[model samples]
Target chain A: MNRKISIRMSGLGGQGVVTAAHILGVATTLEGLVSTVNPFFGAEKRLAPAESYVRISSSQIDERGEVLYPNIIMIFHPHVITLGKCYTMPFFDGLQPEGILIINSEQPLDLSKEDLTKLGQLNARLFYLPATQIATQVAETELSTNIAMLGGLVGVTRLVSVEAIRESLAERFGGRKFLASATTAALDDVLKSKFAQVTQLVDRNMEVVHKASEAVQEYFIKKKEAGSLCMLR
Target chain B: MIEQKIVEPEYLFFQADREEVFITGSEALKEAIKRANVDMAISYPITPQSESMHLVGDLYVEGYVREYFRGENEFAVMSAVAGASMGGVRVFTATGGPGTLRAFEIFPAWAGARVPVVCAFMTRGVNSPLSIQPDTIEMAFMLHTGIVMFHAETAQDLYDMLLKAFVIAEKPDVHIPVGVFADGFFVTHTREKVKIDPAEIKLPPYNPYSSPVPVMDMENVPVRHMRDPFVMKSNFISYAAHASWQQEILAAAERARKHIHKYLGGLVETENEEAEILIIASGTAVSQSREAIALACQEGLNAGLVKIKSIRPFPEEEIRKLTQKAKAVIVPEFNRVGWLCKEIKSVVEDNTKVVGGPRVFGGMTMPPHLILAEIRRCSQ
Candidate 1:
């Protein structure tokens, strides 16, 4: 693993993109690493385009605001790519060479030939997961889709320990109230009401995470003489 | 809530053991106030500033703060905060962007009244077409409000400055309002790691007896004997009285310089001061400058940095001496007005050497590459 990693998470406002970045940031800090997280500055409305940046390093992080050059990009919804519901143009702008891309989709979405060529030039690695499906199936609620995406992140990178992620989940949901925004707070209530207890909420989310981690599949893109070919891993 | 013991300011600030916490800047503000032993806190909601005050309200609920309430508006909140301060209590309040301008009239009143109030200004863009994004143009308006000003660069600075502001504002010679300004969203919403002193120990309560003015308490007899009322008087006596009092307020901030040095270490912190190329900034602009300097260093260019912590005092002497030897001085700012550059220009001998910006306003983050371009340009 690299000494430092910068991640950009893009999704709709209600999809818990900010929460995923926050939980991952906290988990990194819990592992005694440094991390900073911030959500995009905009009017946060349900289903509106939302993005978040998370920087995790073994040392200090001096930068703030959006991660312009991200080593990893997580698309929380297909709309971010398909419908162009993304802040950055082409949904993968500023992706570093050999960067990692994780998309929450049951199957691969079609990428433009130009984008495929660009990714091939950068030697980027890509993965896909049915995170929302996993969330509804395992946790019985779609709110855990963010957790499932995080599980996919762990399965791919192992950036943070599962123990640290569990503790961060407990601290976020069970400890003192955390407010990313008024809208996020209201969403938290809806998520909490779906469970019987705080522990149950944590446990169910963990189950979603584990299932999604196991379900995540990677795509190996081979640049052939004729065209680019993507094979499921 | 755990029982807290009153400790001396120095011990609480420097001697106490600390623990690291992964939290947003708002949580850091709450952590600072939790150990500040505040008597009262008033609230008004504004973007980027609301969360910090909400956390303070949590402190009130946890019994760390003695009194807390939501005011009718920003003006009402500032007025009520002033009233509470004059009543011999350590009062704290916060406002930003439109809220800061809405409550603008009370800032000078707090200073003139000589009430040791600590207000956190989470600066954002004031409305023209209405922007809720982070901007520091509000700090430019706050420069001459007769209050002491401290600009924080990061969450750690926000936490440290807010805690020390109480001690700085309450000095007998100072006894004035202190506004700790942090760039909104950048320092308010961004989650970062901050080291904080233990919550079991707190700074000793504010002592109103140390105030230069009479406390507005029941124990003191009320007196309203003036030979002439200044309100309607268009005479020399009235003008002279008001003029001298304004001078006194400015002098009070000057008196705070020594206290700032004692508590905050210095008005301006310098790094690699001997380098020919220099970057000078305040607030989050300083953080951007640090990154730019590192990039410049990697490119075989030597550039130093001057981070202005105390903006009101202006650090004129230090800035003058620092910029005198530098070949070029780069001033990166979060606002379009370049108020910080103007301050540096006013002090530096060769104002031509000071580059006014790689400025970005309207809530956009100052990318380090932009500042690096300036550094590379100046290196030529």
Candidate 2:
């Protein structure tokens, strides 16, 4: 039986949260798994609160739009939570028990004791990575944070392979027409303008992806050695 | 004499085996039109519809499509589409929400003209408050149009129905326009596995000579192609002709059922034959209903689902047959108007057995739990 796994990624408008979700959807398909990504944004100009939902399954998926009761929640911007910029009052309101929450932060979340207790009660797993920092450092652009976040997604869940993500990245960013529609052409135009300075944009993003993935891998190993303890900030 | 030349769609997107691709509903619909070998696509960009048309616009360079452009507005695009179809080619366009209403007045004329032009309506909320979100309110308004309607549940259905829309709409006897619908982003923006017809097998060409009206190609075309023969005469003749023409459009849609059955499989799909409590729904609501049914079954309740794939011609017989033995029929919808329930109430007759609510408007999701609650209530 093919079961669907729901994911929600939240961030500001400029963080490519939508693009990250799309990349993950494509990566799932590359692994012969079916997936859908529907982005919901309220950006009037840019940097406004944005969210995208992605669902992946081995069988046919019936659900659409936002992924409520998500098993995986990736927040691209810390402001969505700290500044209360999410669509809902409680950003993590309906997370399933034993859910995974990945925060794109430079350091682990310095959560309140109440928040820590809640995660403990739910048996949730928390991971944080310096997604923006990694993107800026490795890919040399703030735009590549989505790529870094996608790498973190793969590393955390292992839902899609790193190789598949690499393939999807090339298909999307490597000057190749994946589906060859006008929308795709427009996306390419945007990318060519954005990534003009990067000599090999896809390659630079791949480096960021690997670095993020390795950090996630190391976090898991450290957690295992620390007596199943979820390290809080 | 009206030529009895029935159009058996020779150019089905696929005649041989299908080749699967992972894509969005927008792309799936576009691919179906591409495989159908559309001659001209006159589109006005609108939410839930622009992506499909924008992508179809790219097909012009691929040689799969001869002409594609963005018209000024829905009304202008619709008129251009009417002209293009009359000019003897397979024509296509799409609109949703306010766009659907903007082009609303042109549809009845298209029906009277008996053009087999196929349009896709990815449903959304109309204006005033101004929302670009998913809603089926506009579809309720369209229920009275003579156009043949097929509401799809998934990306795959969107692809299949669009190809079949051209086939069924062009049935010589059933030449009213076909509008295939799916909810906005729920279907349009969501990517899924949609198997397309093999590229090697192309759809047959659209033959304009078979049209019920004159082909406006400057050859053997009717001189007054815009005016109906009876409507061009006396006032009494015009009223009588218009009244009878409306009936003819309905009759043509009625005649299309068999073809819709043949090409797209069936109008309605029923699940759980022996269940006593039935849930009737359409589009993505059917998908939600399926989950609700499974959950109800897990709770040891006897529940089934009747998914109405064809909304126009309303699938009355199928709904009646499917719900005959059920103690209660739950009609859940994504709109506040309860149009699906209204259609069912008009048919099922037993007032107590029909449940209309758990409706979600303004793009709020009708989660499975909502339907599960309704199913539990109905089971009692």
**Candidate 1, A102-174: lDDT as tens digits:** 9999988887777777887888988999999999998988889999999999999879988889999999999
Q: What TM-score does candidate 1 get on C-alpha atoms?
A: 0.96
lDDT of candidate 2 vs native?
0.79
**Cα lDDT tens digits for candidate 2, B172-280:** 8888899999998888877777888765445567878887777878788356746457646768978897788789889999999898787766788887855888888
- Please name the candidate that would achieve the greatest TM-score relative to the true structure: 1
Candidate 2 segments exceeding 4 Å error: A41-45, A110-117, A175-200, A217-233, B1-15, B221-238
- For model 1, the stretches where C-alpha displacement exceeds 4 angstroms are A1-3, A222-229, B221-223
- Sequence-dependent TM-score of model 2: 0.90
Quality class of the docking in candidate 2, CAPRI style:
acceptable
Pairs clashing within candidate 1: none
DockQ of 1: 0.70
Per residue, candidate 1 scores C-alpha lDDT tens digits across B1-380 of 54899999999889998898888888889999999989999999988899999999889988999999999999999999999998999999998989999999999998999999999999999859989899999998889999999999999999999999999999999999999998888888889988999889998889998888888896766665566678658999889989999999999999999999999999999999999999999999888888888878889999999999999877999999998899999999989899999989998998999999999998787889999999999999
